[model samples]
Target: RRRGGGGGVETAADFARTAPRAGYLHKLGTNVRQYKRRFFVLRPSTHLYYFLGPNDAEPRGCIELDGGGVSAVRELETMPDGRFRFEISLGGDGGEGDAGGMDASFASANDDGGGGRDGGGPRRIVLEARSAECGREWIDSLRSESLPYVRAELESSRSEADELRARCAALEARVEEMRLVERDRDGAV
Candidate 1:
Protein backbone atom coordinates (compact mmCIF):
# COMPACT_ATOMS: atom_id res chain seq x y z
CA ARG A 1 0.00 0.00 0.00
CA ARG A 2 2.89 2.42 -0.62
CA ARG A 3 2.03 5.66 -2.40
CA GLY A 4 3.95 6.23 -5.65
CA GLY A 5 4.61 9.48 -7.50
CA GLY A 6 1.66 8.89 -9.79
CA GLY A 7 -0.24 7.81 -6.72
CA GLY A 8 0.16 4.68 -4.59
CA VAL A 9 3.14 2.43 -5.19
CA GLU A 10 2.33 -0.25 -7.75
CA THR A 11 3.74 -3.78 -7.72
CA ALA A 12 5.58 -4.35 -10.99
CA ALA A 13 7.17 -7.76 -10.71
CA ASP A 14 9.81 -8.96 -13.14
CA PHE A 15 7.86 -11.38 -15.31
CA ALA A 16 10.80 -13.63 -15.96
CA ARG A 17 11.79 -13.92 -12.33
CA THR A 18 8.62 -15.19 -10.70
CA ALA A 19 5.67 -17.52 -11.16
CA PRO A 20 2.13 -16.21 -11.71
CA ARG A 21 -0.78 -16.78 -9.35
CA ALA A 22 -3.74 -18.71 -10.71
CA GLY A 23 -7.23 -19.07 -9.31
CA TYR A 24 -10.87 -19.57 -10.16
CA LEU A 25 -13.33 -16.86 -9.19
CA HIS A 26 -16.70 -15.42 -10.01
CA LYS A 27 -16.39 -12.04 -11.70
CA LEU A 28 -18.89 -9.19 -12.32
CA GLY A 29 -21.64 -10.68 -10.19
CA THR A 30 -23.63 -8.31 -8.02
CA ASN A 31 -26.51 -8.90 -5.60
CA VAL A 32 -28.90 -9.15 -8.49
CA ARG A 33 -26.76 -10.10 -11.43
CA GLN A 34 -25.37 -13.57 -12.03
CA TYR A 35 -21.65 -14.21 -11.93
CA LYS A 36 -19.32 -15.57 -14.55
CA ARG A 37 -16.71 -17.89 -13.12
CA ARG A 38 -13.32 -17.52 -14.72
CA PHE A 39 -9.91 -18.92 -14.11
CA PHE A 40 -7.57 -15.97 -13.84
CA VAL A 41 -3.81 -15.88 -13.75
CA LEU A 42 -2.22 -12.78 -12.31
CA ARG A 43 1.32 -12.04 -13.35
CA PRO A 44 2.71 -9.75 -10.68
CA SER A 45 5.87 -8.99 -12.60
CA THR A 46 4.11 -7.51 -15.60
CA HIS A 47 0.95 -6.58 -13.69
CA LEU A 48 -1.13 -8.26 -16.34
CA TYR A 49 -4.22 -10.46 -16.04
CA TYR A 50 -4.95 -13.58 -18.00
CA PHE A 51 -8.66 -14.47 -17.87
CA LEU A 52 -9.04 -18.08 -18.91
CA GLY A 53 -12.19 -19.78 -17.84
CA PRO A 54 -13.18 -23.46 -17.95
CA ASN A 55 -14.62 -23.12 -21.44
CA ASP A 56 -11.70 -21.46 -23.10
CA ALA A 57 -8.30 -23.08 -23.28
CA GLU A 58 -6.79 -19.75 -24.27
CA PRO A 59 -7.12 -16.58 -22.25
CA ARG A 60 -10.22 -14.60 -23.06
CA GLY A 61 -9.13 -11.11 -22.07
CA CYS A 62 -5.82 -9.61 -21.01
CA ILE A 63 -5.45 -6.46 -18.94
CA GLU A 64 -2.33 -4.53 -18.03
CA LEU A 65 -2.23 -2.85 -14.69
CA ASP A 66 0.45 -0.22 -15.42
CA GLY A 67 3.58 -0.33 -13.29
CA GLY A 68 2.06 -3.45 -11.87
CA GLY A 69 -0.64 -0.83 -11.55
CA VAL A 70 -2.55 -1.41 -8.36
CA SER A 71 -2.80 1.13 -5.55
CA ALA A 72 -5.37 -0.39 -3.21
CA VAL A 73 -7.61 -3.44 -2.82
CA ARG A 74 -10.78 -2.71 -0.89
CA GLU A 75 -14.19 -4.25 -0.47
CA LEU A 76 -17.07 -2.49 -2.15
CA GLU A 77 -19.31 -2.41 0.89
CA THR A 78 -21.41 0.43 -0.41
CA MET A 79 -22.61 -1.52 -3.37
CA PRO A 80 -25.89 -3.34 -2.89
CA ASP A 81 -24.45 -6.68 -3.87
CA GLY A 82 -24.24 -9.06 -0.92
CA ARG A 83 -21.45 -11.00 -2.56
CA PHE A 84 -17.88 -10.47 -1.46
CA ARG A 85 -16.83 -7.69 -3.77
CA PHE A 86 -13.49 -5.95 -4.00
CA GLU A 87 -12.09 -3.28 -6.23
CA ILE A 88 -8.54 -2.94 -7.45
CA SER A 89 -7.78 0.80 -7.83
CA LEU A 90 -5.49 1.37 -10.75
CA GLY A 91 -2.86 4.12 -10.88
CA GLY A 92 -0.44 5.51 -13.44
CA ASP A 93 -1.10 5.73 -17.16
CA GLY A 94 -3.02 2.55 -17.96
CA GLY A 95 -0.87 0.51 -20.23
CA GLU A 96 -1.94 -2.31 -22.49
CA GLY A 97 0.62 -4.21 -20.45
CA ASP A 98 1.95 -7.11 -22.58
CA ALA A 99 -1.14 -9.29 -22.61
CA GLY A 100 -0.88 -10.49 -26.25
CA GLY A 101 -4.66 -10.65 -25.83
CA MET A 102 -6.73 -7.49 -25.82
CA ASP A 103 -10.49 -7.02 -25.80
CA ALA A 104 -13.09 -4.27 -25.66
CA SER A 105 -11.59 -3.07 -22.42
CA PHE A 106 -8.34 -2.28 -24.16
CA ALA A 107 -10.02 -0.73 -27.13
CA SER A 108 -12.42 1.29 -25.00
CA ALA A 109 -9.73 2.59 -22.69
CA ASN A 110 -9.02 5.48 -25.02
CA ASP A 111 -12.58 6.75 -24.86
CA ASP A 112 -12.86 7.22 -21.10
CA GLY A 113 -9.25 7.97 -20.17
CA GLY A 114 -9.22 4.71 -18.28
CA GLY A 115 -6.02 3.47 -19.92
CA GLY A 116 -4.23 6.70 -20.64
CA ARG A 117 -0.55 6.55 -19.63
CA ASP A 118 -0.04 10.32 -19.44
CA GLY A 119 -0.48 10.45 -15.64
CA GLY A 120 -3.69 12.40 -16.02
CA GLY A 121 -6.34 10.11 -14.49
CA PRO A 122 -7.04 6.91 -12.56
CA ARG A 123 -8.80 3.67 -13.47
CA ARG A 124 -10.23 0.80 -11.46
CA ILE A 125 -10.93 -2.92 -11.80
CA VAL A 126 -13.75 -4.30 -9.68
CA LEU A 127 -14.04 -8.01 -9.06
CA GLU A 128 -16.52 -9.95 -6.97
CA ALA A 129 -15.42 -13.23 -5.51
CA ARG A 130 -17.94 -15.83 -4.36
CA SER A 131 -16.67 -15.98 -0.80
CA ALA A 132 -15.21 -13.39 1.55
CA GLU A 133 -12.33 -15.69 2.51
CA CYS A 134 -11.47 -16.18 -1.11
CA GLY A 135 -11.56 -12.43 -1.60
CA ARG A 136 -9.07 -11.91 1.21
CA GLU A 137 -6.83 -14.66 -0.07
CA TRP A 138 -6.73 -13.06 -3.48
CA ILE A 139 -5.65 -9.77 -1.97
CA ASP A 140 -3.04 -11.36 0.23
CA SER A 141 -1.61 -13.44 -2.57
CA LEU A 142 -1.48 -10.49 -4.91
CA ARG A 143 0.42 -8.34 -2.42
CA SER A 144 2.87 -11.05 -1.38
CA GLU A 145 3.32 -12.31 -4.90
CA SER A 146 4.52 -8.84 -5.80
CA LEU A 147 6.55 -8.25 -2.61
CA PRO A 148 9.85 -9.51 -3.97
CA TYR A 149 9.69 -7.33 -7.05
CA VAL A 150 8.57 -4.32 -5.06
CA ARG A 151 11.56 -4.61 -2.80
CA ALA A 152 13.84 -5.14 -5.75
CA GLU A 153 12.56 -2.08 -7.62
CA LEU A 154 12.80 0.10 -4.55
CA GLU A 155 16.44 -0.89 -4.08
CA SER A 156 17.20 -0.34 -7.71
CA SER A 157 15.69 3.12 -7.72
CA ARG A 158 17.48 4.08 -4.52
CA SER A 159 20.83 2.95 -5.86
CA GLU A 160 20.29 4.83 -9.10
CA ALA A 161 19.41 7.98 -7.17
CA ASP A 162 22.45 7.66 -4.97
CA GLU A 163 24.67 7.24 -7.98
CA LEU A 164 23.24 10.36 -9.58
CA ARG A 165 23.74 12.37 -6.40
CA ALA A 166 27.36 11.31 -6.19
CA ARG A 167 27.91 12.33 -9.79
CA CYS A 168 26.37 15.73 -9.12
CA ALA A 169 28.60 16.34 -6.12
CA ALA A 170 31.69 15.49 -8.15
CA LEU A 171 30.64 17.96 -10.84
CA GLU A 172 30.14 20.67 -8.22
CA ALA A 173 33.62 20.09 -6.79
CA ARG A 174 35.15 20.46 -10.22
CA VAL A 175 33.37 23.75 -10.72
CA GLU A 176 34.66 25.02 -7.37
CA GLU A 177 38.23 24.03 -8.28
CA MET A 178 37.96 25.87 -11.61
CA ARG A 179 36.71 29.01 -9.87
CA LEU A 180 39.64 28.99 -7.39
CA VAL A 181 42.19 28.62 -10.22
CA GLU A 182 40.59 31.50 -12.15
CA ARG A 183 40.68 33.80 -9.10
CA ASP A 184 44.36 33.02 -8.36
CA ARG A 185 45.40 33.72 -12.00
CA ASP A 186 43.51 37.03 -12.04
CA GLY A 187 45.22 38.21 -8.81
CA ALA A 188 48.68 37.35 -10.17
CA VAL A 189 48.01 39.16 -13.50
Candidate 2:
Protein backbone atom coordinates (compact mmCIF):
# COMPACT_ATOMS: atom_id res chain seq x y z
CA ARG A 1 0.00 0.00 0.00
CA ARG A 2 1.01 3.63 -0.42
CA ARG A 3 2.45 5.63 2.47
CA GLY A 4 3.03 9.42 3.09
CA GLY A 5 1.98 10.61 -0.39
CA GLY A 6 -1.01 8.45 -1.29
CA GLY A 7 -1.15 5.70 -4.00
CA GLY A 8 2.60 5.96 -4.77
CA VAL A 9 4.19 6.22 -1.29
CA GLU A 10 6.64 9.02 -2.06
CA THR A 11 8.74 9.93 0.92
CA ALA A 12 11.54 12.26 2.04
CA ALA A 13 13.95 9.41 1.47
CA ASP A 14 12.99 9.51 -2.19
CA PHE A 15 14.14 13.13 -2.47
CA ALA A 16 17.18 12.67 -0.24
CA ARG A 17 18.87 9.78 -1.97
CA THR A 18 22.50 10.99 -1.87
CA ALA A 19 24.45 14.18 -1.41
CA PRO A 20 26.06 16.14 -4.27
CA ARG A 21 23.48 14.81 -6.76
CA ALA A 22 25.74 16.48 -9.33
CA GLY A 23 28.75 18.74 -9.47
CA TYR A 24 28.71 22.53 -9.61
CA LEU A 25 26.90 24.37 -12.43
CA HIS A 26 29.64 26.94 -12.27
CA LYS A 27 28.57 30.47 -11.22
CA LEU A 28 28.14 33.85 -12.83
CA GLY A 29 27.23 37.34 -11.74
CA THR A 30 25.23 39.55 -14.07
CA ASN A 31 26.19 42.83 -12.35
CA VAL A 32 29.84 42.39 -13.32
CA ARG A 33 28.99 39.56 -15.71
CA GLN A 34 31.74 37.34 -14.45
CA TYR A 35 32.24 33.57 -14.02
CA LYS A 36 33.31 31.65 -10.94
CA ARG A 37 33.92 27.93 -10.67
CA ARG A 38 32.13 26.96 -7.49
CA PHE A 39 31.08 23.48 -6.34
CA PHE A 40 27.38 23.03 -5.71
CA VAL A 41 25.03 20.61 -3.96
CA LEU A 42 21.28 20.38 -3.43
CA ARG A 43 19.15 18.97 -0.63
CA PRO A 44 16.13 18.88 -3.00
CA SER A 45 13.61 19.60 -0.25
CA THR A 46 15.53 22.64 0.95
CA HIS A 47 18.35 24.42 -0.81
CA LEU A 48 20.59 24.69 -3.88
CA TYR A 49 23.86 24.83 -2.01
CA TYR A 50 27.09 26.33 -3.27
CA PHE A 51 30.50 26.04 -1.66
CA LEU A 52 33.75 27.72 -2.54
CA GLY A 53 35.01 24.37 -3.79
CA PRO A 54 33.87 20.73 -3.74
CA ASN A 55 35.98 20.02 -0.66
CA ASP A 56 34.33 22.75 1.41
CA ALA A 57 31.92 21.45 4.06
CA GLU A 58 29.80 24.57 4.47
CA PRO A 59 27.85 26.37 1.77
CA ARG A 60 28.64 29.82 0.48
CA GLY A 61 24.98 30.61 -0.01
CA CYS A 62 21.78 28.65 -0.39
CA ILE A 63 19.29 29.54 -3.09
CA GLU A 64 15.72 28.68 -2.17
CA LEU A 65 15.08 25.77 -4.58
CA ASP A 66 11.38 25.21 -3.93
CA GLY A 67 8.37 25.89 -6.18
CA GLY A 68 7.28 28.88 -4.08
CA GLY A 69 10.58 30.42 -5.12
CA VAL A 70 12.67 29.34 -8.10
CA SER A 71 10.83 27.81 -11.05
CA ALA A 72 12.89 26.04 -13.76
CA VAL A 73 16.50 25.55 -14.81
CA ARG A 74 17.49 25.81 -18.47
CA GLU A 75 20.78 26.16 -20.28
CA LEU A 76 20.61 28.58 -23.15
CA GLU A 77 21.47 27.07 -26.52
CA THR A 78 23.91 29.93 -27.01
CA MET A 79 24.80 33.18 -25.32
CA PRO A 80 21.77 35.57 -25.20
CA ASP A 81 22.56 38.22 -27.85
CA GLY A 82 25.45 40.00 -26.25
CA ARG A 83 28.27 38.73 -24.09
CA PHE A 84 30.93 36.01 -23.81
CA ARG A 85 30.66 32.48 -22.36
CA PHE A 86 27.62 30.14 -22.07
CA GLU A 87 24.81 30.45 -19.51
CA ILE A 88 22.20 28.49 -17.57
CA SER A 89 19.13 30.27 -16.16
CA LEU A 90 16.79 29.32 -13.35
CA GLY A 91 13.17 30.43 -12.96
CA GLY A 92 9.71 30.54 -14.65
CA ASP A 93 10.50 27.97 -17.36
CA GLY A 94 8.68 30.27 -19.78
CA GLY A 95 5.26 29.58 -18.23
CA GLU A 96 5.47 26.06 -19.68
CA GLY A 97 5.53 24.47 -16.20
CA ASP A 98 5.70 21.10 -18.00
CA ALA A 99 8.32 18.88 -19.53
CA GLY A 100 7.08 19.19 -23.14
CA GLY A 101 6.75 22.98 -23.40
CA MET A 102 9.90 23.96 -21.51
CA ASP A 103 12.82 25.03 -23.73
CA ALA A 104 15.35 24.66 -20.96
CA SER A 105 14.71 20.92 -20.76
CA PHE A 106 15.73 20.47 -24.39
CA ALA A 107 18.27 23.17 -25.29
CA SER A 108 21.98 22.46 -25.02
CA ALA A 109 24.47 24.92 -23.56
CA ASN A 110 26.47 25.72 -26.69
CA ASP A 111 23.93 24.83 -29.38
CA ASP A 112 22.58 28.33 -30.18
CA GLY A 113 19.02 29.64 -30.07
CA GLY A 114 17.22 32.32 -28.06
CA GLY A 115 18.17 32.86 -24.43
CA GLY A 116 16.40 31.39 -21.37
CA ARG A 117 12.61 30.98 -21.26
CA ASP A 118 12.05 32.17 -17.68
CA GLY A 119 9.17 34.53 -18.44
CA GLY A 120 9.46 37.49 -16.03
CA GLY A 121 9.73 36.04 -12.57
CA PRO A 122 11.94 38.17 -10.35
CA ARG A 123 13.62 35.09 -8.91
CA ARG A 124 15.15 33.98 -12.18
CA ILE A 125 18.93 33.69 -12.03
CA VAL A 126 21.24 33.19 -15.00
CA LEU A 127 24.79 32.02 -14.49
CA GLU A 128 27.71 31.37 -16.79
CA ALA A 129 28.84 27.83 -17.55
CA ARG A 130 32.33 27.43 -18.99
CA SER A 131 31.26 25.05 -21.76
CA ALA A 132 28.23 23.49 -23.39
CA GLU A 133 28.82 20.29 -21.44
CA CYS A 134 28.93 22.13 -18.11
CA GLY A 135 25.68 23.92 -18.83
CA ARG A 136 24.02 20.64 -19.87
CA GLU A 137 25.07 18.89 -16.69
CA TRP A 138 23.88 21.78 -14.51
CA ILE A 139 20.52 21.94 -16.24
CA ASP A 140 20.02 18.21 -15.90
CA SER A 141 20.99 18.14 -12.27
CA LEU A 142 18.93 21.20 -11.28
CA ARG A 143 15.89 20.00 -13.20
CA SER A 144 15.98 16.54 -11.66
CA GLU A 145 16.72 17.68 -8.14
CA SER A 146 14.14 20.49 -8.05
CA LEU A 147 11.11 18.55 -9.39
CA PRO A 148 10.27 16.48 -6.33
CA TYR A 149 10.23 19.52 -4.07
CA VAL A 150 7.90 21.31 -6.45
CA ARG A 151 5.51 18.36 -6.46
CA ALA A 152 5.56 18.15 -2.70
CA GLU A 153 4.98 21.87 -2.30
CA LEU A 154 2.08 21.73 -4.73
CA GLU A 155 0.55 18.86 -2.83
CA SER A 156 0.89 20.77 0.40
CA SER A 157 -0.65 23.87 -1.10
CA ARG A 158 -3.64 21.88 -2.33
CA SER A 159 -4.27 20.39 1.08
CA GLU A 160 -4.11 23.78 2.72
CA ALA A 161 -6.54 25.20 0.20
CA ASP A 162 -9.02 22.41 0.87
CA GLU A 163 -8.83 23.05 4.57
CA LEU A 164 -9.42 26.75 4.08
CA ARG A 165 -12.47 26.02 1.96
CA ALA A 166 -13.92 23.81 4.67
CA ARG A 167 -13.36 26.52 7.26
CA CYS A 168 -15.07 29.09 5.07
CA ALA A 169 -18.08 26.83 4.62
CA ALA A 170 -18.41 26.32 8.36
CA LEU A 171 -18.16 30.07 9.00
CA GLU A 172 -20.85 30.74 6.45
CA ALA A 173 -23.19 28.29 8.09
CA ARG A 174 -22.58 29.87 11.48
CA VAL A 175 -23.23 33.35 10.14
CA GLU A 176 -26.50 32.23 8.57
CA GLU A 177 -27.62 30.71 11.82
CA MET A 178 -26.87 33.97 13.66
CA ARG A 179 -28.82 35.98 11.10
CA LEU A 180 -31.85 33.73 11.54
CA VAL A 181 -31.74 34.21 15.33
CA GLU A 182 -31.51 37.97 14.87
CA ARG A 183 -34.59 37.93 12.64
CA ASP A 184 -36.53 35.86 15.22
CA ARG A 185 -35.66 38.36 17.98
CA ASP A 186 -36.79 41.27 15.78
CA GLY A 187 -40.09 39.58 15.07
CA ALA A 188 -40.70 38.83 18.78
CA VAL A 189 -39.99 42.44 19.77
Residue range 1-189, candidate 2, lDDT tens digits: 134555564232332347546454545544444466556555655456555655443344455455444555554555564322433344443311221221343212221122334456344445556566666666666665675656877899999999999999999999999999999999999
Q: Candidate 2: lDDT of 51? A: 50
Which pairs of residues collide in candidate 1? 2-9, 4-7, 4-8, 4-9, 13-45, 93-117
lDDT by residue (1-189, candidate 1, tens digit) is 232455633222221125456667655432334446656677664454534343342354444543545665677643345457776666555443344344444333221122222254455555667677777777776665554556877899999999999999999999999999999999999
The best candidate by lDDT is: 1
Name the regions of candidate 2 deviating beyond 4 angstroms. Answer: 1-17, 79-121, 147-189
* TM-score of each predicted structure versus truth: 0.48, 0.44
Residue 48, candidate 1: alpha-carbon lDDT: 44
Q: Which stretches of candidate 1 lie above 4 Å from their native place?
A: 1-20, 29-35, 52-55, 65-68, 78-82, 95-121, 147-149, 152-189
